[model samples]
Target: MRATTEEDATARAAVVARGCSSPIRTATGVWVRCGSRIKSKCESCAELYRNDWAAIARSGVFDGPVTEFRFYLLTLTAPSFGRVHRVPRDGGQRVGACSCGVEHSATDAGLRGVPIDGDMYDYAGQVAWNRDAGLLWDRTRRRMRDRWDSLEYFIVREWQDRGVLHVHAIIRVARFEAPTPGVLRDAALSATAVSQVDAGVLVEWGEQARCDAFRADGDGAKTIWYLSKALNYVLKDVATASVDAPIDVWRHQVALGDAARRMRCARDCQPQDCMNLVHKRYGSRSQVVSASRRTRNRTGWSFTGLTRTVQRRLRREWWESRMRDEAGDDAPALSPPPLEDLAARSRRELIARGWSAP
Candidate 1:
């Protein structure tokens, strides 16, 4: 990565990792530089990416540009009227791996399934909700701005396809130089105007997905924090019967005998332009793709996905349960499932309930 100017060089120098001279060595910290730039480079890690050429990124440099991030993660649960065995987010223990073999402590991860899933949830609605969750949340951002007037800045909206169903967003609220503070806090954000705006948007999405999206049926603007924070938009693979319900063993057996399906059929489902989608979502049209796909880099699938996935796991395992605890029997705060508005909802509900759309 070429340093465009001297300031870039100085900024890059700040986070550069250094090495200690110990025969029994730990890996070296990495930074991109030249002879006069910064001599700090880990030869061991340099071997990991000899062809690497991407600038390291840091935050808090921009003046008056405060960012609010919303990560959309799937909340798993049992499908309606179906046998319940969705992958437990933490398998119902204080400290253990998820059904997917992810391991962590309850003090660290929280009670299993308390955050993402619980027994007796409407799973079908969640899946249907996932299909176009972006549009749903986008509407909320607009409505929120209109109602509150304080949030009238910019929104970074996107989704994550890795997990069951989820979204991610970066809300940029412009700061006034006079008296504005940092990111808006919960208590400060819970004004009547804001709550009413949330209610309208929430009801609209719930009605579209054709299921009550919230744990509590009505009056839940205070709990829609989930939709507000989803900028990365990765859908976590859920273990809920409702959303990721068990496949029918009999149906699978019959399909195996009837035909030989190409494994590529599964490949057909995955998108070729995930990085491109990320690029589109972030409005970074000409983002440098100079590094090879195989290289272990920040933008690659493994590194970014791993950090995001672990975060989802940690969030499901930690934050959700705590919020539920704080909310008590009252339903905990969560992302409002993203969905189409009344126009789209009318078409689908017509079909689901055996009616017609005019």
Candidate 2:
């Protein structure tokens, strides 16, 4: 019994050391790492996720002929629903008086996103905007492509302290017709979309948009780094509001949640009965990160064709090779057992352990 317990403890330690805190057995009877992107859930997996996307982002800027393309880092914000306190971050300079007639300090961070007047704040409009944000972006991108035919982009959607979604995009275009940063910013900001669900509503971006062109060999690396860092924000399950939040801040989040819960995510959605995650996510239904994909007529977002799938395949091959090398030529064949046999054996073991087998 002691020997068996010791062996089990050693196996668990090995798994932890390999950065797989949670391993799940697949239908094929192979155990694999749970690919969670949230750092709080699994730091190792989250780091891998961040690193994979970062590599893909870098490939888009560095792999192709640098001088042949123009790169721009663009930021777009959501339209404000109402006035909120503008408290600077820790160690940041103080802004002037807020609309409420108070110069907020960093210590007032708890009220940063809280509405100045809860009754007047457009909670319904904010939630509705969040629901339609993806559609708006689709229209915006199409409009931009109409002017610049060679546009390819990678975007990360970040949550503002005010519980709204904003965009940070790395955009690439052929140099023949690249526009000035100011022009690009103007064009993007001017683009708008009509909501398909709520036909009467018009979707638009806030006036706080920016676009900055950078050289692929110079500021481009720094721009990529900045966007890559935003990936960490994407891992959060929801808005930053917490249980111990200030009363006003808590009420603000509650209002957003209530708004989201009642908002129609789809044309056929029944708010009370819908099980969609949109209700729990502050009315946003879009993915946190995405990139252009390769098509017959396009080179895709990554110039070197480095994507998460490619990274995974490469990692798996390297891992297998290392395992074989460690086993040595004198050892038995390091190849895995046949899938069918493994599956049958796994089923029997599961049944013996009083667990259902798929």
**Structural similarity to truth (TM-score) of each candidate:** 0.26, 0.86
lDDT of each: 0.26, 0.80
Candidate 2: clashing pairs of residues: none
Tens digits of per-residue lDDT for model 2 on 196-304? 8787889999999989889988898798889878888778655554666689887888899999999998889899999887898898989878889988999999987
Residue 331's lDDT within candidate 2 is 65
Residue 180 in model 2: lDDT: 95
Q: How well is each residue in 142-228 modelled by candidate 1, as lDDT tens digits?
A: 554454343322122222211222222223222331112222222122212211212332212321111111221222222233332
lDDT leader: 2
